[model samples]
Target: MQTLSELGLAVAQRRRALGMTQIDVAKRAGVASDTLSRFELGKATDFGARKLLAVLAVLGMEMQYSLEGHAGSLESLAREHGLRR
Candidate 1:
């Protein structure tokens, strides 16, 4: 997603879809449950890349990168094309 908040929401959705608990994921990812909770709530300000990768790994997810203009906020993309949400 284009923003940390969006990413957090996506992670929460994925975790729920997999029937996983925040505590379980935190334990498996080697991070504190509080940290995981903050992250899932889009309230984490200092979550490092390594920890993020670890969490993603535990969730069977991976990050993907694309050229700058190829991927952006859905709202921005829609606006650019004069489309409605």
Candidate 2:
């Protein structure tokens, strides 16, 4: 999960898990379907953090980070932040 490819895969997986089409998420995030497509393909760098955050929100998701030397499942980190994951 350290590369754009990994990020794209995670996004795709989550999107599928939620039964959401690409167009649905793009509309919800106010981005073009092509942008979302490129994002999910790991082939674009123009998708900024704000757009990414918006898309994640639409997917009922969030970004979580651990300290560089600390490693754990994102669910665990979310729980630490008082989230149900």
Candidate 3:
């Protein structure tokens, strides 16, 4: 499992790669600039899923779970077992 600090670093790297400022992401995600700043600084302890998703969306990314070195689609596997919609 990735630590929150690692995830925050990933988010910051992605945003920087896209030349996006914290205020830009805040505007796009409808969050406060300070909130996004805290997220990027790894100071946020309890990030809400929807807010995190919004932030990822602004950075042109989506959250997913996967096993290490797996090539198969998790969604497909889940559907095969009727595990998720």
Off by over 4 Å in 3: 67-85
Instruction: Please provide, for model 3 over 11-31, each residue's C-alpha lDDT reduced to its tens digit, 9 standing for 90 to 100.
Output: 999999999998999899988
Alpha-carbon RMSD of each model:
4.4, 7.5, 7.5
Q: Which sequence of candidate numbers ranks them by TM-score, best first? A: 1, 2, 3
Please list the C-alpha lDDT of all candidates, in the order they appear: 0.88, 0.88, 0.85
Over 4 Å off, model 1:
71-85
TM-score of 3: 0.73
For every model shown, what is its TM-score relative to the native structure?
0.79, 0.77, 0.73
lDDT of 1: 0.88
Question: What lDDT score is found at residue 68 in candidate 2?
Answer: 83
| Tens-place lDDT digits, model 2, residues 11-77 | 9999999999999999999999999999999997787998889999999888988688468678877
Candidate 2 lDDT score relative to the true structure? 0.88
Residue 25's lDDT within candidate 2 is 96
Clashing pairs in 2: none
